[model samples]
Target: MHIRDPIHGAIEITPGERRLIDSRAMQRLRHIKQLGFAELAFPGATHSRYAHALGAMAVATRVFDAALREAPLAPAERGRMRQAVRVAVLFHDLGHPPLSHTTELALPPLGALALPEWLVDDPGRQASHEDMTLKLILDSELASVLERSLSDCALTATDLASLLTGRTPPSGAPFVAGGVDYGPVLRQIVSSELDADRMDYLLRDSLFTGVNYGKFDLDWIVQNLCHVVREESAWLALQRRAIFAFEDFLLSRYHMFMSVYFHRTSIGYEAMLRRWFEESSDAYRLPADPQAYLGCDDVELWSALRGSASEWARRIVERRAYKVVYEEHPKDPHQAPAVESALRAAGLPVIVRRSKGEVSKYFGARRGIFVRTERDVVPVESYTPLFERYAEAAVLVRIYVPPEVREEARTVVARVLS
Candidate 1:
């Protein structure tokens, strides 16, 4: 099957992948918006998770092929690893609920969700969409479909699930049937800092939102990829010449987060959605079971919004969102509290939101990306000053208030700032 994606052009799916895409769980992604409530701000940003999944798969294939060119593996093992990478990236976002991460904040704590043993290791961590995706792949009908589709390659649902999590499989693990282990290189193709997931989403989100901030030299980066084995561990590395392209990619991500993902309007609506969900969670509880949770989507939320009596839901439905009274890039972190106090003292209802602007934390760690130098492989940050400068910068601190009180709130905030 060939899908004409706006971001990746024509994406050709293999017979196995076509079958997996046709499954009920895959089809469900068609209704889930990739950017959650961002459409409220950017109407063109209504693309679905289904499209993003296909794009991720396409990019993963490109990176996998590039890595295989330098990887040492038998022909049969190469074919198996290729199929595993494809399957892992294709279904990585299958478990995302309706509205994506917007509603994820309202999901019950990890303890409340009846997650499988493999996913329960981090009890203190909350149950996220990734956790949900892992559960569906292992415990739902999607698991059976994956197992059957990749049976010839000796790949099981567990194998694909493990790859999606980007973790190394244990020696003699149950998932490693026939003693075949694709190793960390295959997992990195889908989940690493510069993996297919980030590559596709940056371009895809930029295209749908009509923004050029997320654009980067994807072809240059992909073409320059090489696999390196150092000290018995494998990693995906890029040619030293592509350092500029790699730096551009990181800068593009940071710009997109500032201009699109964390746009004041998008943040306001997301906060509103969280408020609505919290107020209505009792009447509309998120399912603890993976299968039941699969049934929940944007449609369910729309239904509740249309029929609900909650003020928060009604406000969203009517587009009566809170207004931003004051926004600034704080020079001193300690001033935020004083600003909030001044606003309250002036008789204004205020909610102060601070956003950290460190884009490198997601992409600049020691294990994140590597440059294949003539002498040896080195971490990208070791030779790049851009990474260190913007590694952890505070971006915005905005105070929100009801629309009716916005004018008064602004005056109070101005006084605090002065």
Candidate 2:
């Protein structure tokens, strides 16, 4: 199947891949929007996760093929490695909750997933969307399909799961060849800070949102990808010359978070959705069963909201979302309380959301992508000043109020800001 994506042009899917894509688990992504409430802010940002999945797979394939050129892997292992990364990236977002990360607050406890000890160490904590994806791949019918598709390469769902989860693959098999482990580098292509997801999403989100903040030199970055070995484990590395493009990619994601992802309108709606999910927890619960998850898309969630009687649900379903009365920057003080207090005193309902945008969570401990110079290899963070400049996570604190009381909320905000 040839998928014509606006971001990657033509994305080709093989017969084996088609079976996975056609599975009910994958089709659920079609009803789930990529940006969630972001569509309310950017009208054009109504793309589905299904589209993003295909785009990420396409990007990962290119990265693997390019970086593999520098790796010394046996011919037999090369095909398996390539297929593993492709499957890993393609299903990475399969477990995302309805409306992306918003409704994750409504998920069951980690123990509910029944994941193996090797996969998740803490089953007592709240489950994440990724946990759901992992179960879907490991235990659901999708797992059967995944295993059968990978039968040719002798790869099981657990092996592919290991690639995404960064765990041991059926006996700590690290794609070893001649005593060198190439698993790290291969997994990094689908994940890591410079993975295929970021590569495609930056450009895809930018195009769909009608913003240039997420646009980066992807072609240049991909062409300059160089594989390197660190402590005997292969790692993803960038050519010294393409370091500028890598910096731009980091900045692009940062800018998108501030300008698009963290837009106040979407934040306000998300806050309301969170409230509704909490209030209606018993009435609308997320199932632990993977097969039941096929019906748990945004459509079902929206329908529940539309049919509910709760004030939060009514506002979200009626498109009468709360308006952002004030925003606090990363360096600003915490004044959301004062505004929210004054609004409550004035008989107003308010939602205070603190959205944290990390500059690069992966670059903090010198474990990020490597900058391969002609002489030596260093952590990308140490190689670029951009990391230090963006070291502090960008914080956006927003105070939201009903549209009818927006003016009154602004009055409260002005007093708080003063």
Candidate 3:
């Protein structure tokens, strides 16, 4: 099947892949907006995770083809690795809750989900959408469908799940070509700081949100893919020439968070949603059952909010989100706390949220990735100061108050600013 994505253009999928995309878990993404409440701020930012996954898969294919253009791996092994990386990227967000991260608080403890022992880190920790996704693919009926769909590729759901988890398969690595363990490189393509997921979303979200902050030269970066062998394992690497383009990709995501992802209006509604979940905990709880979880999406959450009496829920349903009284950029002198306190003293409902962004946290590029220079292979951090420059997480603190107290809140903010 050919899908003409706005961001990636023509994305082609095999018949089995099409069937999997049409599965219950995949279809659920179609109803869940990628930016959630951000759509309320950027009317055009109503893309879906379904589309993002397909785009990421397509990206993985492109990155794989380019990265291995002259590698020593045989064609058959390359084919397997490509499918593994592509599908792994395709399923990475299978577990995101409706409205994206807005309702993750409603998820049960990690132990509650029937996941494989190898998949769980700490059962006591609250479950995330990623955990839910792991459960669906490993233990749920989706596993059967996944196996059936990929029978031709001879890859099991376990193989794909291991790729997502970044773990070795039961007995050995998933891909072995000429004594090289190719599993780590495959996992990196799906995850690492420069993974296809980030590659797809930055462009997808930027286009849908009508912002240029997230735009970067993805083709240039992918075209420069290279791998370095360390201790018998192949790790994802970049050619020395495209280091600047890679930095631009990191900047694109960072800028998007500063400008679009953390827009006060969107953050206020997301905070309000969290407040509603806190105040009305019994009103909604995400199911641990993978099948039941499929029923949880943005539409269902919105419906629950519409029928609830919680003040926060009412605000969200009525499109009366709290107003941002003050915002503190990551490096700006702190001011949100004082404004937040004064708003509360004035008998106003307050929501304080801190949106965090970082450039190179995900794959531990400092240790895992190497930049292959003409003379030698060196750690990415040492190759450039970009890592140290963006090591500090950008924290955007937005303080909001009930819209009814807009004037009162503005007065407090003005006094504080003055």
Candidate 4:
């Protein structure tokens, strides 16, 4: 099956992948918007997760093909590794609930989700969309498809799940029970800082939103990717010549966050959605069971919101989103309370949300993105000053108010901040 994607052009799906995509769980993604409420701001951003999964799979194939040329693997091992990476990227987002991250924020705290025992210690790192994706792949009908399709390649659902979750096997240890050691490089392709997921989403989101901020030299970066043994483990590295392309990719991500992802209007609608979820009665509760959760999608959520009596829901349904009274990057932590007090004193309903600039933090501190130079491999940060500068910046803060009270709220915020 060939899919003509707006961002990636023609993406070919194998018969096995087509079967998986035809499954009910995968088809549900068609109704779940990639950007959730972002469409409220970028009208063109109504693309679905289904498209992204295909794009990521296609990009992963291209990247893995490039890296395979330099990898020291037998033909059979190379073929198995290629299939594993493809399956991992294709189903990585299967577990995302309706509206993507917006609903994730509304879900119960980490403790409430059914997390594996290993992740219990770090409450902050508990069950997430990745966890959900792993669960679905392991327990759903898709698992049957993967096991049957990959039987010839000697890969299993667990292998695909681990790859999709980016699980790093212990250094110098074989990844599979039989001593196969393709985990590190495959995981990096699926989940690293410059993985196929980010590469696809950056271009895909930019194309759908009608914005040029996220555009980058994808071909240059992909063609230059090389797999190498680093610290006793295989890691994805870039040819030194592609350093400029890598920098451009990072800047493209940062600019996209500022211009599209964190646009004031988009944030305002997301805030309204969260408020609706919090204030609504129990009738709209999300399912805790992984299987039940699969039944939820954007259409279901929109119907519930449209039928609700909550003012927040009404505002969202009518597109009467709240106005951004004030928004600033590098938020002042100490001054927030004063601004809130001033807004309240002026009789304005206020909501303040702090959105961390994750693209910077993820690439800056992740310790990935190595540059393979003539002398030796080095972390990109060692040579790029921009990484450190952006990593240290504070999270962005946006102050919101009802459209009618926006002017008053803005005045109060300015007076208090001054």
Q: Give per-candidate clash totals.
A: 0, 0, 0, 0
lDDT of 4 at 111: 55
TM-score of 1: 0.93
Q: Residue 137 in model 4: shift from native, Å?
A: 0.7
What are the runs in model 4 whose C-alpha is more than 4 Å off? 108-126, 168-180, 331-337, 363-367, 410-418
TM-score (all chains, Cα) for each model: 0.93, 0.96, 0.95, 0.90
Range of the 10 consecutive residues with the lowest summed lDDT in candidate 2: 276-285
Local distance difference test values of all predictions, in order: 0.79, 0.85, 0.84, 0.78
Displacement of the residue 282 alpha carbon in candidate 1, Å:
4.6
lDDT of 1: 0.79
> What TM-score should be assigned to candidate 4?
0.90
Question: Could you tell which candidate, 2 or 4, scores higher by lDDT?
Answer: 2
Instruction: Give residue 12's lDDT in candidate 2 (0 to 100).
Output: 90
Q: Between candidates 1 and 2, which one is better according to TM-score?
A: 2
Give the per-residue lDDT of model 3 (tens digit) for 1-418.
Answer: 7999887899999888887888888888898888988988899998999999999999999888876777797777777788778778888999999899878899999999967777878999999988888888887778888888888877888888788887765566777788888788888888887889889999999888888999899888888898877778788889999999988888898899888888888888878777777778546789898888989998898888888888878888889888877888877888777777777887887778888887767535444677989899987778888878878888888887777888888987898788
lDDT for 294 (candidate 4)? 76
Tens-digit lDDT string for candidate 2 (195-289): 99999888899999999899889999999998887778888889989989988898899889889999998888888887877776434578898
Task: Flag clash pairs in model 3.
Answer: none
Per-residue lDDT tens digits of candidate 1, residues 1-418? 7989887889998788888999888888998999987888889999999999999999999999997686667777778888888888988898787788877765666766665556577766667888778777877877888877888888877677678775544433422323443466677798876889889999999999999998999999999998766555567788999999988988898888888888888788777777776667534456657778777888987887778788777877888888887677746446667777887888877666777766566544446567888998887778778866776686688878889888887777778777
Candidate 3: where are CA atoms >4 Å away? 363-366
Judge candidate 1 at residue 364 and give its lDDT: 44
